[model samples]
Target: MMIHAMSASALSQMDQPAFVAALDGIFEHSPWVAGRAWPQRPFASREALLDSLVDTLRSAPRSDQLALIRAHPELAGKRAMHGALSAASIREQLGAGLLACMPEEFALIRDFNTAYKAKFGFPFVIAMSGLWRGDIIAAMARRLAHEPEVEFAEALAQIARIAALRLAERVAD
Candidate 1:
């Protein structure tokens, strides 16, 4: 697939559907974030567009927020192991070295995935760009202890970090 990069000015000029399509993959499977934030475009900077998108997610109802979080596949879990993740997810995990774990670490991460989901009702979501598998494991261990409300907030923050990274990749300063 070809990645279409354009100036923020050009992106700001797009019609709604085109804008939504352009940013479709930024939030995993939730293009609605862009769609809902569409009217806020002609963004003065990439940061403004990012703020709009993240704000949309932040203001979403509880169920929708949960849906967005749940849309992300577990790290190194079945979907990733089976190669079913989105391109950005693949690169993020592969960059973090989550895809090449030793057997022991892999099993531990799988266990964390199961327990974390059972506890929080959503898969663990982290921005995996500069992290190593060990860092991910430590983060999972640490975040697993958070209360549901706290964890939920943390999840959104992490998603925002991820969106910021992705937006930077697709949009220029």
Candidate 2:
């Protein structure tokens, strides 16, 4: 196996603990994701590190994966309303126009969250980095109809996308 090095200057220099600390929130509240990926460092580039992060997650047991998925807060739900989200999540949701939803749009999201969670046993996961609220609403409605297994896979994929975006922003290639 080829072992590569971390490319982000600060990240490249960190010991395992510090490195995990720096990336703790990249995968929502799952710092263990970064902790697991640290053994594979130094990553050759940011993308490689992100791949490792996603790979670590993909290798996890189903229960662990579900836990990671459930760790995310609902978009425009109680967390957003009460400022309980992580700083990164707040910025991401706000940028996606979730925090600016008109009353009707907000209610729609609330309804969707309720229905989606009731179906899948976890929050609907999406990468809202550059998406508008309408896009999110449409996707949520469409995804709600997916089979449980399909939706579970899709949720993991979306989480990877979110983690990739967050990691990219934090680490320069």
Most TM-score-accurate candidate? 1
What 10-residue stretch in candidate 1 is worst by lDDT?
1-10
Residue-pair clashes, model 1: 0
What is the lDDT for 117 in model 2? 99
Q: For residues 1-173, what per-residue lDDT tens digits would candidate 1 score against the true structure?
A: 23566667888899999999899899999989999998887798888888889889999999999999999999999999999999999999999999999999999999999999999999999998788999999999999999999999999999999998888888877
In candidate 2, what residue range of length 10 has the lowest lDDT sum?
A: 1-10
Predictions in order: lDDT = 0.92, 0.89
Candidate 2 Cα misplacement greater than 4 A, ranges: 1-6
Question: Which candidate number maximizes lDDT?
Answer: 1
Residue 90 in model 1: shift from native, Å? 0.4
Error of 2 at 98 (Å): 0.8
lDDT of 2: 0.89
TM-score computed on alpha carbons, candidate 1: 0.97
Count clashing pairs, candidate 2: 5
